[model samples]
Target: MTGALKVGIGGWTYEPWRDNFYPAKWPHKRELEYASRHVTAIEINGTYYSTFKPASWAGWRETVPDDFVFAVKASRYCTNRKVLAEAGESVARFVGQGLVELGPKLGPILWQFMATKRFEPDDMRAFLALLPAGEAGVKLRHAVQVRHDSFACGEFVEMARAAGVAVVYADSADYPAIADVTGPFVYARLELAEEANPHGYTDAALDRWAEAARLWAAGGRPEGLPYVEAAPPPNQPRDTFMFFINGAKLRAPAGAQALLARLNAPA
Candidate 1:
């Protein structure tokens, strides 16, 4: 059996979306409600820079649909540092800061590193060790987005796989793209949207991404992507989360919705 595939944008709150995506004069507070209905999932970017109250997390959970999920970006303190191995306290604080309030709505927690951060095997392993398997009864899935080219190595993939932590597949011109499926689930960040196109990406591009998402959900790797390791893993269905992020930020929602439409279409 194939796993579930979710397509979404980085976040719901965007001024451009208010004019193009949301209804005219829609309540600002209900943007999440509207966006959640359109997309299958969302990657919460705010949590990476700031902390929210437990009530805020609970309120967000109430706003989204039952099947909708949110992938939260872990705090900068937990990722941006000179020494990753020393981030235990920060990691614990970020993980325990009421993420459990989201309950089942919580998906993966993205740990994004700075562009300058290079791969250090021992340090990375230590940081991975600090990531708890669960938080307050909710099983947590972690995905790391490493920006530097140094991360594009088999050793890094091996370490992540050993820890059951997915190495984020970043489709960006500036970042190193690693398509290695190192964990039980797949996390992808697509950042090639264009402002000129109404849907950010071309129809052909969207079709290709949709097909790739399907292949990933079915435990099969897609062609034309870079991989650190040449060998394939055992075939096992895995949940897939793909988000339209970064480039042409204003068109992210459209791209996400269009991709979701393809995924939900008759197969």
Candidate 2:
């Protein structure tokens, strides 16, 4: 738990958030400005559907605070390819599109595969190899979100670790949850938000997650979470990222804010 704990929602442009999360009468254009001030990180989902101009990326960077980080979902053109190895050009284009404009605010690039996509170790290895260690001198981080149940195996974890790629810890009933920590950092997408609890998750759930983040930051695997391996190897501390997404989306911001409060982390 020596590093930072970043708790945030998937995206800030939801229509429901305007009434529930944003300040009353807040300008729509200023939503990013406001959300950035309240959360440490944001998962940019728009990029997953389409590409943006370089100016758009630069403008987004200017809108957020200096310490705020944005984790971008890789474009479908890249992740949706049949052969991952053939996606090198698409990967380069996606990265070069305007990610550099995001600069230091850029966080990990999430590569979410189709639900039908099964685990192919060789393809996965090639895909991971395409992920650049750094772009224009700034270190790059990549997280793979494999939805198929076949990915719930020790071999997949080993392959991810070999490629230095992180296997996203997806907390969702629809997908197989793999809590293994393959990289130095932990990426979690919590989809258990409850409408009954306006803060997204109840106090007890938040407490458990806070404790888990501490454990991960301390280089230890948190007990109770689903894992392919028995335990993670002892290592140095890591930065932990937890995002509240799906399952009562309107309550996501509240859940993120509540978790941040527990971690004693700045928004």
Candidate 3:
């Protein structure tokens, strides 16, 4: 496959979206269905706070369209540990908690470290090594979100690339925005959305981000983003996942839809 581009929101279940994104009088049970139809993918935020049962995973898989995908955020127990290496069992358990049930609909599993968590080379390397290539004969993709500035080095990018794991490109002032492409795919979190804009981002901003995503999909780094390396590789194809999160939370779904349309529209 050349690669696919997914644009979506952080989650589908939000009360605020009822009056804004979702249709009035819509059933809660149908939220996923409606949201999935509007966006190509969604970042499952619930998984970050807690684990779910196999039946739940299966039901979620059945709720959306065949082309819809979900990127799960790993639980805090696995990534927010005092010792990263010791989180092996937690990681294993989290994966075992029925992620495979999502089947073909499962996208990348995101591991987000806390803002206070610095990058310790050995510890980070050990943790990355512990991440499985696949589970139950199903291949899995992974992305890491390190909030520390220490992760902006070439070593971190090299290590992640060697493990075939992507480093999440978070667009926010609070976190260290690292744009290093370290894997076959790219994971991005656009956190600059504003509540004032019902569409999440202005048209000019959307245009800029759409162009940036195009470059990334073509295996080139986008300008105006900080990078560990000066130059990117040739135009090799890569799958891309872009999410509108942690900013203007209420307008996120609208922003996701806008970006999705932009990505799918004619050049």
Candidate 4:
């Protein structure tokens, strides 16, 4: 990549991704700033699992640096449904509060949807339409992480491009080939298995990622198709996120760090 490669731990709250060593007993609120010292970013998991007060969010914003960014998971109300919900005041309230509150600090809202056996273009269309209608005319990074195997086809890519959304690239057990991932917006949900993926940063993988990143940086950023990564490090150091998705506990974040190292290495 021409510009600096954005690199960071996957998250901050969890134990294995962080440390209880220096923290005072049980309460550890100022973790984001601490994590930023060693890493560049993190996916905000707390927003997904539970609601946060404005004060809590403000505290988080205050903790991080200017360059550090946060990728927030869209709440259950938005992503859990097969079809997009109607445009209601409550929906506006949920989105508006977040958009207004998070402001520039928010990296991308990862809209991770439930898996379907078959691709439903209608469902995808509805979801795209339902997204906050321009978030009060302000554009912040946004992306969709669809989990169905059927969503990996050329049709799916075309649909996303037409709608100005991104189909996330992921490593999972459901797809025929994880190697099939290809798209403009690169929201890479990298699942790390040390033995399964030795070293994680293969030369070919680095080359592909580097090219994509370079292209994305050179004014090729897809609208609402923000690229994101959610891989925790393998050894679990440096406050990476550990999400337990579909019974697979993505362990420590060493792999993600390696990815960052590779991506940022001298071109």
Candidate 5:
């Protein structure tokens, strides 16, 4: 379960998820199952954009293997704006059924806020109050990927620690603050498709990251570790979900394989 952390792909790497490979060409169910065969984890972006039915969850559970994990995005309607003040029942349902239902396969419910947004200390308070308290018997991670840089202040950490939530170190165009924090719980959303279409983390980049991961593996608690990846596009990163990296959509399977190879390769 723990070998240099796990690697994953976004569920709908391309719009109409079935489209990246070919909307009109490939079978729907087969593509996901095929993808699952390689990577053990996937980020579920759809849950954020839309709600899901129990049948869908059951079907998804059946599709993914026991070892596979699903990281879901907290519904945008609930977290993006200042709606946490009204998270109420609808939001609870979204988190409980969508996130908790995944059982052990659930990784983290990533609450990714929009860029223009800011964390009014009050908003953070409302958010924590609304979030599911997590399982009494388990320790599931809850991460917040704040887009605006303001949340990076020390006050945010206080908020996270107060709620026992993990602050996600998201790789995006915003303030690189995501990779600059630490806490009891940790989540890192490595984004690749943002910078140069492809991060091209030369040997130097890979080497540096490798060293850091090695250090983390060896027992060092740095803020957030940078994972190499590409962000979707300005037009749609989360819309595609996970593998929004540059030069690697139709070829996402290849990209995941490559990253693993690099991770496993001896320094």
Candidate 6:
């Protein structure tokens, strides 16, 4: 089976995007409506910093297209602590906070770690165990974004795979890029956007990413990406989620749209 590929930007609201992506005179409230139509998915970065009411989540769900998905960023309180096992309360609060209101529109929850946090195998295992398999009636998917180079080891990949959690393949100059497929799905964050290019990336770069997305959807790892494990993941199709984030934030939407166009084009 060939799983679906979704390409999108981090958050929808940005003053710069209003000028380039949004229509002239478009109401600020309807920005999500416009963005959801243009991209297949979006990573909710705001959720990482603050909690919202159930009505807010529901409203967000209602504004997007039927097939659009929102990948939520887990709150910093849940992952920034010294003891991963002791974060049960924070994790519980985050999971119980109106995420189910999005229902089927919700995708993976990104558990991002700070750059200073080193990899502790035992602590990491305990943390992964803290993530519940399901919340309310909706099945939950999780992806972890580890920034420290200490996480760039086969042991980390193996542990994530055992827990059925995807290790985020962050394409950043500062962070260690771990492209191992450790879960049933693939999650990637592209962060090398440049203001010099209107689309955030050159046409060649976009094409390369488009192909990479296709390969990942087909359960194949693309070449040239850094990986800790020498062995490939199981040759089984899996859903692929990609987001254009950070760096040249102004060009993110255009980057997402351009990549989506490439994915939608004929083979």
By lDDT, who's the top model here? Answer: 6
> Candidate 3 vs candidate 5: which has greater lDDT?
3
Off by over 4 Å in 4: 1-4, 18-27, 85-91, 175-185, 195-252
Instruction: Write the residue-wise lDDT of candidate 5 on 48-147 in tens digits.
Output: 7788876777677778788777778777777765556876666666765645556677677777777777778986788777777575344466777777
lDDT of 6 by residue, 82-155 (tens): 88889999999999999989999999999999999999999999999999999888999999999999999999
| lDDT of residue 62 for candidate 6 | 96
Model 1 per-residue lDDT tens digits across residues 1-267: 999898889988889888689999999999999999999999999999999899999999999999999999999999999999999999999988898899999999999999999999999999999999998889999999999999999999999999999999998999999999999999999998899998889999999999999999999999999988999877899999999999998898889989989988998
What residue pairs clash in candidate 5, if any at all?
10-242, 192-229, 192-230, 192-231, 193-230, 193-231, 194-231
lDDT of each: 0.93, 0.88, 0.89, 0.52, 0.58, 0.95
* Model 3 lDDT tens row, 181-203: 88889999999888899787899
Count of steric clashes across candidates, in order: 0, 3, 0, 9, 7, 0
TM-score, predicted candidate 3 vs. hidden true structure: 0.97
Question: What tens digits encode model 4's per-residue C-alpha lDDT throughout 129-189?
Answer: 6665357555655567776667656666666666655455554555422222233233556
Question: Over 4 Å off in model 5, which ranges?
Answer: 1-4, 13-26, 135-139, 181-185, 194-203, 217-219, 222-252
For model 3, the run of ten residues with the poorest summed lDDT? 228-237
Off by over 4 Å in 3: none
RMSD (Cα, Å) for all candidates, in order, is: 0.7, 1.8, 1.2, 8.0, 7.5, 0.7
Rank by lDDT, highest first.
6, 1, 3, 2, 5, 4
Question: In model 1, what are the clashing residue pairs, if there are any?
Answer: none
Residue 245 CA displacement from its true place in model 6, Å: 0.5
Model 5 TM-score (2 dp): 0.75
- Tell me the deviation in Å of residue 2 in model 2: 1.1
TM-score of each: 0.99, 0.96, 0.97, 0.71, 0.75, 0.99
